[model samples]
Target: MAQYTFRTRSSDCPYELAIGLVSGRWKPRLLEVLKDETLRYGDLKERLKPVSDKVLSAALDDMTRNGLISRTAFAEIPPRVEYALTPQGESLLEALGPLRDWARTENGR
Candidate 1:
């Protein structure tokens, strides 16, 4: 069975409530892509080619619902919707910086 971590301040889980907000493969990747600029749905699909549309949609929806990403709608001939990270998401990205550095340096990535 797929298990989720539910931890308190003293709980055994290494991360806190914040990390749990982005506890999936595509979540981190999605955030990484959105760190510098906004991306549209098709852009996301193109950038994350290995991920299926269904999985990408689910991850983006989850992030949006969790106050991580913002979805903007524009009235154009074909319509435009862009996604960007919210302040909370930006904070999360900052927090993960050190960990990302460690992962690259120590894990030889």
Candidate 2:
């Protein structure tokens, strides 16, 4: 486990806590991509084409800080790093299913 300073008062409200965990430009999209398998930084960036490096990096960092994702760095001459959902993040994805279904219903899907 690691400690971090949250940008919001997450401990004060459940809504804030939930939002703070996943609200960002590319968080939901990133989560969807990571739901199935682990991916290296380059692979993730490729899958998330059109997302600038800065944006993706920030999103990954925020998610990592919140315990939503785990980052594994490998030692090698050319470094390799992989990102995957943590248990908490998998739970978040499971919780999102109903919300997604609701949105689809609203959209008449």
Candidate 3:
């Protein structure tokens, strides 16, 4: 269930205040993968390397619903499909900079 919070100023739902769309365990990893380029479903699943089909499918649906990612389908005999991040999602790359800086500053990796 979704939790509720109140704003004495505007009184909006926390769902709208979410941190730039990527959430849950698999999502961040998915974004990391997509940062390079658009990819096919099989390529993503292979890069994720152990995620189950059901979990990945659900994650993809969630991202698409949140407007963080785009899915394109092509009309080929085999049906080509690819996934890429939206400009909104691309904007989040900068927001995650601090964490990357911290990881390097602390872990030295």
Q: Candidate 2: minimum summed lDDT over ten consecutive residues — where? A: 1-10
Model 2 lDDT at residue 8:
33
Expressed as tens digits, the lDDT of each residue in 1-109 for candidate 1 is 3333432212344474656777788998988999999999999999988999999999998889877899999999899999999988898888889989999999888
- lDDT per residue as tens, model 3, 68-89: 6799999998999999988756
lDDT (tens digit, per residue) of candidate 2 on 71-104: 9999996998999998888988888788889999
Better of 2 and 3 by TM-score: 2
Q: Give the TM-score of candidate 2.
A: 0.87
Q: How many backbone clashes does candidate 1 have?
A: 0
* Regions of candidate 1 where Cα sits further than 4 Å from its true position: 1-16
> Candidates' TM-scores?
0.80, 0.87, 0.76
